[model samples]
Target: MKEGSRLLDEMNDRSREVFRRVVEAYIESGEPVGSRTLTRTLSEKVSAATIRNVMQDLEFLGLLDSPHVSAGRIPTQLGLRMFVDGLLEVRDLDHHDREKLDATLGAGAGDVGGLLDRVGAALSGVTHGASLVLTPKHEAPMKHIEFVSLGHDRALVVLVFADGHVENRLFAPPPGQTPSSMREAANFLNAMIEGKTLSELRRDMAREIAARRQELNSLAAEMIETGMAMWEGEADNSARLIVRGRANLLGGEAEAEELDRIRTLFDDLERKRDIAEFLQLAETGEGVRIFIGSENKLFSLSGSSLVVSPYMNADRKIIGAVGVIGPTRLNYGRIVPIVDYTAQLVGKLIAERSER
Candidate 1:
């Protein structure tokens, strides 16, 4: 297929008008749009035959396709891309949309996890499509570390971040360890491991303990290693996947085989690891990324569409992503701006949370 940018440039005034009308009609009705409908609705002074000829040219350009020989042409993936990139005029969030978004964002504070869950649910409700929110990767520098004795051989290691985020990990103390040893180990780590990444602290602590065998008691060194191991495990499991509105996919008209494929897609999404990988790709991208049919291997069977945008922190570093997934017939002109706006809103919320 030709690049959407080149195809958009090649379209003349009359052809562009016909193409826009057909794309708009198809998006609204989710059906093939005939030239007659364009003639009736468009304000342009053009006959049905003229519109038909232009649509034929657009079909040759791979922007339009006819599902049936007798039916009119509908916008293809390329057509949607061209319209979204060149023709679609994104409007400001309307009063209703702004009010709904504000209400959703205002419902919670302090708990980032709860705020993200509500954001995903609100997005799904507004878009009528599946919504996804990938949790921010923890990159805060360590401020302090402490190991508190909980019970028999099990201790709770509290990690305080420079951003005021505190996470606790439960760990079993190494063999032949006591609460006094654990306390000593905690003091040693708090003195040496402050303002370092978990990985950095782990590597440095390992080297120090290995080099100085006789400098400290064996039990104290073992307790320190145990606490470091717990922090590493928690960091590995920190990224979360939030998905909502799987039921909305079933409401559309699709063949049984297609429905089965969609079910499989949902199953794949349920695996948090895979979803995290997918969202990670978008998180590193420059801006909103659109994946059309057959563009990604995961959704090839379902021929689904994904519109994603990364949400950033106060420093403009991408911390997460928010997006919608639906069938190829999704309204890109409408949904693209919605996703973009929502991403910005998510970024703002994250920045505020980080400041706190």
Candidate 2:
């Protein structure tokens, strides 16, 4: 499809009015809009014949589509993109919306993950669609690491991230490793890599081990490698895509024919790794980003829409993102501002917690 930038300014005033009305009607009722319906819904009285001609012109220009031979027209994904980028006017959140967001997110949660989960759940409840929150990873440097024997060659690596996010991983000791060796390993790592990001620590450890393999104690090096590997793996997995409210899509007012499409979307959501990487694109921009159906690689096959906005830290750095996913006929004007506001609230909450 042609980018909205090329086609948005090419439409005549009459075509633009008819297209806008058709899209608005479709978004409200989730149904195709005929010329007669457009005539009744539009503020200005336009003849049905004129609307039909305008719609035909829009269809020809790839802005609209008729799903059935006798059915009314609906805005194509391209059309929705154009409307969102060029024609859409975002409304301010109502009092109820503001209050709901404040009540849900304004309170200080104990940790970053809890706050992020609440934000995802609230967005899902508000938009009635699947919500996703890509959480910030390793928000603070490591304060401590410990290991306890679970017996029978198993041990637990306990992590205390500086921000108070604690995690535990099960590990197997390399032949005859004891609790003393484990403590020694933890102490050595703490002294060597304290105040460094997990990523940085991992890189430094790899270089140190390579350069001084013989100088380093064999048991200490082995323990550090095992512990660091677990930490790295957990960090990568924990700060991944958090998807909620998948059932919301199926339980909505969609028709039976749309079941296959929803199932396809469910399968797509199951690809969490891909979704997490795809969401990173949102962090490149400053404000809300809307990906209409087919416009995004992840949602293209599912024929869905995504509205995402990045959340920032106190340093004004974009750390993660929150968004809603649903069918293309979503209420753009309403959902756009809601997602935008939720993102801002999440950023504010994270920043406040960081200061604490």
Question: Each candidate's TM vs. the true structure?
Answer: 0.72, 0.78
Candidate 1, run of 10 with poorest lDDT: 229-238
For TM-score, the strongest prediction is 2
- Number of clashes recorded per candidate: 0, 0
**Candidate with the greatest lDDT versus the true structure:** 2
lDDT of 2 at 228: 69
Model 2, CA-based lDDT: 0.80
Off by over 4 Å in 2: 107-109, 142-195, 202-237
Q: Model 2 Cα RMSD, Å?
A: 5.2
Q: Which stretches of candidate 1 lie over 4 Å from their true place?
A: 140-237, 284-287
Task: Tell me the whole-model lDDT of each prediction, alpha carbons only.
Answer: 0.78, 0.80
